[model samples]
Target: MLSYNSLSLYLQVVINLTLLTGLILLVRNGIKTMEVIMLFLSGEFALELTDLVDRLLKLNTLNTYNYALSQFLGLVMLTEIYSRYFLKVPAFVKWIIYGYAMIFLVINIMDIYHRAPVTFYSNIISSIIICSFAAAYCVKILQKGKVEKSLFIVNTFVFLFFLLNA
Candidate 1:
């Protein structure tokens, strides 16, 4: 007796998980920085894992909190990893990013548990964050002079879908 909405969301989760996995495998043979890219890919996979968990089970307040926190953490880690491809960020900056995201994650967990709504505009705000990361990923592809056109388009498209659904 699955509802259409939940089924659709789960399907999207599966789709994203597949794409991320494929991209990770495609880049696995690249030299030098392949290991780092693989690490971020695994981080991306974590999002799918949490999304599946939230969608399959009866989600309570704690479950919702964890779901949001997973998205928050996943975006932060993936973006920080991606920033390496675009910007010449310092090592200290990475630590700072992790620290800031952890702080926000804790606050968000509390907010979700307390039924305190988010202050950062809306869920659309997180969508914007994802879009921005996708942009950064595009820049990396461009810098490398690779034809990552499909990846770029699909990333933006998927982010927009989530944004609208949010």
Candidate 2:
């Protein structure tokens, strides 16, 4: 029987493969949002693959950095997705997103310099931010009473995933 750690690694690999396949299909079909999703998936897959390799090789040095970087990138990508989805959102909302991103970056940099493991805080903050964006999108859809089926599906999944993870 596989150990828990081994099983999780296998699961991650499966997920990465699935994401890669979906990304390829999206690219081929030339979806308008393909570029954003493509970049996000590509970064995520690369980071995940690196992490898997690092674990298998037992090179544990960069694990914290890898995790932190992945979380940061995930937040940025999700923000971009939501910003595009809610194009009519107020100017202040965009400013808030920008401000939060800057603060997050500063926190990550300070943590790295001080050799502090800050993934927990970063993860929580990012999750909340992402969930907020997803929720806002959902509200907008409801108010409009017309849904972009694809975006609604994506937003729903993102909201649930981040909410649970948070």
Candidate 3:
């Protein structure tokens, strides 16, 4: 009788863990940093871990840790991939990362105080935004057949949960 979101979150974590293990292996294998492999692996690991914490604690069903992590981690992985594949951006991207982290920090404080359903639901909304941007970037890369090695594992993690109900 669990909600679909919870069900998906659980499956996503499992897939993400699997992807993270693969990323760790790739990191050990070579290819250095920011390879297609590295970006994907890092994203998968950070994202999945964030979701796992939310699940384990049963906090903020909508505005969960996973939700917050999705935005932050998306920025991290995208930066890695873009920096590797495209132009080197301004150093401000680091501050951008910090910005997202700060927002998450606030959300955590709110979690302790309010524990509102809105907090958990906010995760769903943020995740949707993250997913949309990711999908667009993924499509651009997929078209070129030039995805980061890590992306394949990340894709597996994302897809596995979305289809788990089947």
TM-score for each predicted model, relative to the true structure: 0.59, 0.73, 0.49
Candidate order (lDDT) = 2, 1, 3
Candidate 2: tens digits of C-alpha lDDT, residues 1-166: 8997798578667756755665676667677754786787678779877877877887656765676677777787777777776545566876777677667666775676554446567678788888888877878877889987666755765676566555
True-structure lDDT of candidate 3? 0.57
lDDT of each: 0.58, 0.70, 0.57
The TM-score obtained by model 2 is 0.73
lDDT of 1 by residue, 1-166 (tens): 9987677676757656664755555465453444554565555556556556666675556556665666565556555555654445567766665676666666676776454466253355555665666666667677888755434544554455445435
Arrange candidates, best TM-score first: 2, 1, 3
Error of 3 at 118 (Å): 4.4
Q: List candidate 1 segments past 4 Å from native.
A: 1-8, 27-32, 59-62, 89-100, 113-116, 119-123, 136-166
Q: How displaced is residue 73 in candidate 1, in Å? A: 2.2
Q: Is candidate 1 or candidate 2 better by lDDT?
A: 2
